[model samples]
Target chain A: MTIAMTTSPEALTACCTPTGEPAMSEETASSLAAQFKAIADPNRLRMVSIISSSENAEACVCDITEPLNLGQSTVSHHLKILVDAGVLTREKRGVWAYYSLVPGALDSLAGALTGRS
Target chain B: MTIAMTTSPEALTACCTPTGEPAMSEETASSLAAQFKAIADPNRLRMVSIISSSENAEACVCDITEPLNLGQSTVSHHLKILVDAGVLTREKRGVWAYYSLVPGALDSLAGALTGRS
Candidate 1:
């Protein structure tokens, strides 16, 4: 998946350098772009909002599909894209999968964008 | 163009409520996605980094194209997208257009993503 091409969470976390601080290396820009691309879709952004605001900041696919008005398969696809980008983590609970925001992932991206590190 | 559909900077600034705080409304999600879509390209992200790190936190298109290895037209297109998204402000200086990061724009986006007010 495209996730393999993204910067590791460790690299991303350490990369709190703001856009105003320095010129971004091609590698860093590519990695950041991959993460942004994950959330660039309207459906995925809504899914992130819904999943993030859910109980424990996590939710099952069933919990999101209805509010998003997207079918289960579509929601699942978006979830996979997010997960692959390291923005969300997936855990297996019997027959269903639960997804939760990865701690610090969003913060790292924010820091990079805002130069708030 | 598409910028007309985006949420106003005022709305985005007041939207530091964070993703975990509540489910984002469709209007909010769409606006955020439009902003993300603007920077989702690697070339654009690099251009932003270069421009933001330049003198006075701004740069002329000529200053960025060579480092970015992109033609002036391509660089201008990306800059226009960012300006339209309100992430960057454009000013005419003589015959050159200077682009600078809009104050607090990235911070607002970061705040929304990271749930930091």
Candidate 2:
């Protein structure tokens, strides 16, 4: 339910302020960049899309790898990067790891870029 | 006011559908990834932030570099990437090159990720 990014508290706080308000501090830009970087790969982008579209807006590694035709390790790798970026949350249920979008994470990122904040 | 990404029409069409709708084809994912890759760097994100927050929601390279403490060449490099990705529009006003967000570009990207479509 709760996912945390590796970005520092200060950077995270500064990451999604509406554009044109002020120049972002270097730390803030770097933090935001990291989030973008996580989804910059085609495989990762597809993984996010697949998980987001799943029932209950969540999917396990098993579900993702099949549709993506990617190996489990590869899917897991992408999932880890997303989780580290705070874009996705990982929950362990029995032998499976289920990934879900962190509420508002993408919205805030989008809001930051689109001046929607 | 019109900015074009290097992404093909098919990819563009596929880029912004709601995430839960279906798995993105490889081309769509790649196109979306290219857009994300353009903004994946700290400097680029700041450049976008600076431009988005400016008067009329636009900024020139000169205006952007000064605030970021970067050189003209460095700033230009980042701008070109954004333009190529179709995230920003480049306009030549006399000798200065002005950059503005491509209308709805960020919104579409955000919509894809956040299920806002």
Candidate 3:
């Protein structure tokens, strides 16, 4: 529910600058932190991996919950966190919500790790 | 005191895998989380910025504390965390300890964020 559209790499770059730079602006820190917070938890991190490695780099909540050995609602909550972080994309298909990687979102974050991007 | 030698990028790369590929191994998660946890604090994040943007990509604790408006002990603690996380390198110079960016540590973390190495 607290998600916004991070529609481009520039937006992500602008919002999530290098720590080697001037740290990051407060808003940028908060936004980038939100994305990191999504993965801060071990459960959510695992969920992201499972979801990404799924068929076509995406998976539905139903498929995600099984390998996780967690409750359905718990899986849904984690999925929402990833979607909100701009790390994953979610689409509604008939009666299910399908989730996939946000193309370069992870790559952008990876770029921060490499100091490029 | 809880830190170990993270001497190379291969170590960093092998240690910190892509979150999307799979949740990082537990050991990798703990190590990478230690780095993120270092920056999780607002004060530390700010301090890192000031230190990183300083001359020579490094700064002494003496220069770092003033701009932060924080206690000297607090600054020292944060510096230790960054050093331990492998994000910043430390060297003893006479009576002072000089800290500098650990080359690609942040880049590696940024890699995690962007989903690359």
Compared with the true structure, what per-residue lDDT tens digits does model 3 show for residues B8-49?
A: 444343422333444445566566666776666666666666
lDDT of 1: 0.79
Evaluated at residue A14, the lDDT of candidate 3 is: 40
> Which 10 consecutive residues of model 3 chain A have the lowest summed lDDT?
A11-20
Off by over 4 Å in 2: A1-21, B1-21
lDDT of 2 by residue, B5-104 (tens): 4355744443233444558789988988999999989999888888877778887777787778888888888899999999999997545677999998
Candidates sorted on TM-score, descending: 2, 1, 3
State each candidate's clash count. Answer: 1, 2, 19
Model 1 agreement with the true structure over B1-117: per-residue lDDT tens digits: 445322566433432323334456789888989999998888888888887677678777767776777898988888999999999999974456778999988888888787674
Question: How many Å off is the CA of B109 in candidate 3?
Answer: 2.4
Cα lDDT over the full model 2: 0.81
Q: Is candidate 1 or candidate 2 better by lDDT?
A: 2
TM-scores vs. true structure, each candidate = 0.79, 0.79, 0.66
Error of model 1, residue B49, in angstroms: 1.1
Collision pairs in model 2: A20-B53, A53-B20
